[model samples]
Target: MNVKGKTILITGGASGIGLEAAKQFLEIGAKVIITGRNQAKLDVVKKSFPSITAIQSDAGKEEDAQSLFNKVNDLGGIDILYHNAGVGVPPLNLGVPNNNHLKGAIYEMEVNYFGVIRLNNLFMDMLKSRDEAAIIHTTSILSIVPSAIEATYSSSKTALAFYVQSLRKHLQIINSKLKIFELLPPLVDTDMVADRDDKKISPAQLISGLIIGLENDKYTIRIGDSKVIYLLNRLLPKVALNLINPNKYNEKLIN
Candidate 1:
């Protein structure tokens, strides 16, 4: 769980939470390598943080995942793989018969859920070979309670949350020393949600909490409203559902 002196590869590191995490991890003495689809953004990150190794790669592409693994292997491999790349299609009226519904769902699944699996499969052996290694999954609070407005996004994160748990148990059964950590973050102040009026925690706050969790070996790291929603969902599912999908969102969904 010690991050110092470890090499961590983070996906979608050009901006938002991933960029913040890269900065914090670098400050803590971890060698940070970040991947993003945009080469220009990667260049900007590389220029700003000369210590970070920025790579242009798309997380959702299988070919890109294999290429990234090869590139990282040539750079001496990584001790941690952080799955932070996720995409959410614009809100669609699923209740109405529309072609875009399935398309949006598939796109979300491809980037947010399947992308993690692809990278994990590519890096599993490399991670297992390390003396101390870990995999971090950035799932969302919506994984606990579905958001009517962002249904596909919620489903994608929920799928990933389940997979992370199962993967952790599987690794444990095999007596693997590699640690699996699931980070459940509430609404974050990032480009992805810039249009939303909902309250959000700064990326710095979220990543700071994540660092503390990593240092202490906390497998399930829930920050901000994520903690509250998780507890409420466990005790009062209806209340938790209402909290996530308020009247305004419900009205939007109906119309």
Candidate 2:
């Protein structure tokens, strides 16, 4: 899993964790292709990193995934598919609990969960035929724990966490070399988080975890704050659940 000389495709690469990953991969000398929904943001990112390949595609859509595969295959085959694009930002501390804004919840699940699945379903084949194929997903602490403000987002990742668990077991029987890794990142200091130090883990640290996951060839990988969740979920599922479920811990958040 030497990152150098590998061909890679990253979804949601215009900004945040995806863009940071693209930069890190470029520094390590990998052939990088980045996809984003926003043309302007993609253009800006492309300008910043002249060597990177920037394509416009919404990673959440099935058609977008298909088009991305076609375009990447045309340029060159892919070795690593990084599904990192996601969205989950709404007002927390609303002074009410179970504050389920139906729209916000839907957006969280659609963008964070289904979006990654769509791309993975499409790109799995392209990577499978190649040597040293791998898929890296960006999950969060909420995936395994709770967040007062990120209820839907956490739930989406939790579902994803389980989905990958099954997917990994199936892939193991078919192809042992195909690696699956999840980054349980802390609150990252990206646009995704505007008011917290928990997102303190740098993109570099996350990329380092990616490399470690590849080198070890481990079936499951967890890094940063999500590591806390993984441990807590195992030894203290109740504790972890209480911390992440907003309505449970925050009285004001309960309706």
The numbered model that scores best in TM-score is 1
Model 1: number of backbone collisions: 0
TM-score of each: 0.98, 0.87
lDDT of 2 at 124: 79
Cα deviation at 134, candidate 1, in Å, is 0.4
Point out where model 1 deviates above 4 Å. Answer: none
Weakest 10 consecutive residues of candidate 2 by summed lDDT: 246-255
lDDT by residue (1-255, candidate 1, tens digit) is 789999999999999999999999999999999999999999999999998999899988989988999999999999999999999988877889989989999989999999999999989999999999999999999999999888999999999999999999999999999999999999999998898899899999999999999999999999999999999999999999999988888767777
- Clashes by residue pair, model 2: 96-253, 96-254, 97-253, 97-254, 97-255, 146-244, 147-244, 187-199, 188-199
RMSD of each: 0.8, 3.0
The lDDT leader among the candidates is 1
In candidate 2, residue 184 scores what lDDT?
73
